[model samples]
Target: MILTTCAACAAPLAHDAPRCVRCHTRYCNKTCQHDHWRRGHKQMCKKIHRGGNAEQYHADKKYKEAVAVAVEACADDTNGEEDFSTLRAAINYMGSLIQLQRSEEAKALYRKTLPVARRVLGESHEMTLGMRTNYAMAFCADPAATLDDLREALTILEETARTARRVFGGAHPSTRNIEGGLRQARARFALRELLGQAVPGELAPPEPQLAAAATPFAAASAIAGHLGMDPQEANAAIEELSELKARDPEAFAELMQAALSGEGADAGDQDP
Candidate 1:
């Protein structure tokens, strides 16, 4: 039998005594429910009531209101420890913002959540690592994000992907998600440079060490096929990878390490 626990306090609950009407998160009693509401659920009620599947809630792309709801509810963190449930609600809200192309807000929430997650959940905790991946994806997805922003996003995704693979192994979905994000970040950053859309100085110049690694974007072809990106875009990404190998061997090597265990990466990546 599945044991159900209260969403707020994690106390075991009776079979069907009480649950929030909108979200249906269970609670042990009215007191816990009230406390959770005052802390966050009160705000979540209307957002969840937006009345459709998770995808439908964002159909109109109006996430500002839902974000506001999370912000207001998440504000009452009187308990010294960060409230995981409220924080998770905030993340979901931020995801909606990102889905709607509201990058600034999504990035802001990502910044806010990372440190708390690191502190409360530890850096290597699956949840913390997942947050890191989400944060990087949010930044990389933004058209307005800078060249420097791509650098930071890729760095985070690379390290997080490596760590997730080490911890959860290659089969876990989290590990797979990080791998996919790394591929996308690389493609986006490379494409931007290939198109001359980014500032030249923001990227490093080719280095001697990278001369040995200049194949560039072994992942782009697969990405192009999977995402239906233009073939030329994929080729440009490969050229960009070669440039990265020339410009910054360390970054190139990191990408290889991050990707080594997934997507049938070549055995040569093992050395990088």
Candidate 2:
């Protein structure tokens, strides 16, 4: 939920806020956790540890469970109350979704909350900025993320990193986190450029020339005949992929994913 504030005492929590090992509760430190334990968590903690608290259980780790909880919580209308904790819960649940590799769902959550966050927290507020970070990072979650997607992510990170430095100072935790995100985005961008695979398009030329045959079977036979005739060339082409894998593992993996999706004929094309 925009973890700028501590979960226990409402104090500002830095980037490295300590968390309860068992339930993953964030705290400013041992004192806050201890105080919270005395307040009521002494029992709540036990319930979570014993798996009796479904909310706590869902909130901590499971992907599908977290999605269910977030969906249910978001369904509750706070009726435009700015201070409602349910909104925060929704935002935090998006983070959990992203953490668990449910990026598509996280993207949907960010799209919904980004406008609301801007209205409630203002554009430059920490919570809004955090959402921006989450939105940008979400684009990178899919294994089939395109070059355009990575570039879009990089653009958002670059702007977010710059604004974070200006508002929070370079040394601030938020600024540092954005900077790290920028680095990863850059790496993805570079990989896309360097690897430039060809994703197939609708306009792909006819397969080695089944183009001018009278019937489907004739074309199929012609192609089969050529396959027997040019077995060496086919073997060479297949080995090229292995060479690519040995040379650059990351790009090769990206290419493999794209190829498996039948996108290899025009993967090199970038989005406008």
Candidate 3:
């Protein structure tokens, strides 16, 4: 979640909280804002703006903290500690990396530690199993992960689920957890496959002429075909699009540009 508290005192803000006009860093009142500015925001305001505003800057800061904690935990685990507590801490730290969308970093850590974990904790140990589960999850958690990555994750989950059921029995919590992970992986794979089928070849930006020639209803119908939506849902989407275009023409124009360019809408252009 994004930080919603004052920059100085960490107090929750009211609807009309005072904020820095430059970078939009919020505070409970002008006093807190001034205190924060004198303390640090003066030097940090431009940096925060460059780092995608206050919320994203704070989130990136927390991700760095998690990275630090994970590194320390892993270092501690490496220093002659084979106990469950240390191992679990290391595993959980890696999980925090994945949860914070640092999947590549999480995967690197998993590769480095999995062998050691198996040697020290054994294959069926809960810590080892948890590490394996999280490693598989990282494969699919990356935003840029492809269909092959999803397949790899599914394969790992299937094998892990089978092992958990055999070793821990069906009613065991570990078994249940692995089973749940397997189910989710399967669902993700299926959904990805369905979408791939919808657009058989590599997806290219819509042709300008085709887009211009198509009526809104016709465009909606085509989109519905690709997304497996019904006619009513397509109509509803068109209505929503119409409302958006009417309410915020600039935003609507930006959305169109993004669609044409095959890029995402700029988050910086959005209201904080």
Candidate 4:
């Protein structure tokens, strides 16, 4: 539910309590409003506005808080246990962590519980399949994930999806979910490949003299050396990037930003 208490003091507001003029964050009185603004709301106001105002923003925050609490409880309850219940809790916990963008935490949980889950539940079991699906998803959720990471995720999803289809059939929910994850992983892998190709070869030049000169040819040679690519392949990629930038500056900028920051690669394809 959306938080209705005063933003500053958590006091219940009257039906007509004053609200921030911009973000419409409710306050018990003018003093509380001013205090909240001074304390932190000044910085949060624009974010609140962008997040669909105070009600939606606070509601989302509240939901995430509840998920966090649940995750902690699951960790406590499932620790050192190797039963079905523990496996279930671990899967749910990993999903919550992924939702929270805590990819490292989710990955840790997966590594810890996956072996036990496979042994106890068997590979074709629905729970085991679900856990595998979520683990692959954790890779895509990681903002720092590289091309190799995406490739790993795609590989896992492909194998899991095949197993799910054979065990549960294509019409089953488990198979469908795994298939969906596979599709997303495939797309992310392809996109990452394209972005990798577009990346400037100058990131790691070869010869010290060539590296110092800052030329695309030198950069391509360096990239070829580092990535074990043919120099011609790197040069071709640079040419493609140049043509793409010239043809569509905005699209090129977006792709470049995605490649550099490792953003927009999140699959968000986990089954609830």
Candidate that would win on TM-score: 4
Candidate 3 off by > 4 Å: 1-15, 18-74, 81-86, 204-272
TM-score of each: 0.50, 0.49, 0.55, 0.59
Residue 195's C-alpha lDDT in candidate 3? 36
Tens-place lDDT digits, model 1, residues 244-267: 768987766555433321334333
Residue-level error in angstroms, candidate 1, position 170: 0.8
Candidate 1 residue spans exceeding 4 A from truth: 1-81, 197-272
Q: Which portions of model 4 miss their true places by more than 4 Å?
A: 1-54, 78-80, 201-272
- After TM-score superposition, what is the CA distance of residue 55 in candidate 3 from its true location, in Å? 9.1
lDDT of 1 at 24: 58
Task: Report residue 155 deviation for candidate 4 (angstroms).
Answer: 0.6
What's the best-to-worst order under lDDT? 4, 3, 1, 2
TM-score of decoy 1: 0.50
Candidate lDDT scores, in order, read 0.62, 0.60, 0.66, 0.68
For each candidate, how many residue pairs have backbone atoms clashing (under 3 Å)?
6, 12, 0, 1
Worst 10 residues of 1 by lDDT: 210-219
- Alpha-carbon RMSD to native, per candidate: 18.9, 20.1, 11.7, 12.0
lDDT of prediction 2: 0.60
If ranked by TM-score, best first, what sequence of candidates would result? 4, 3, 1, 2
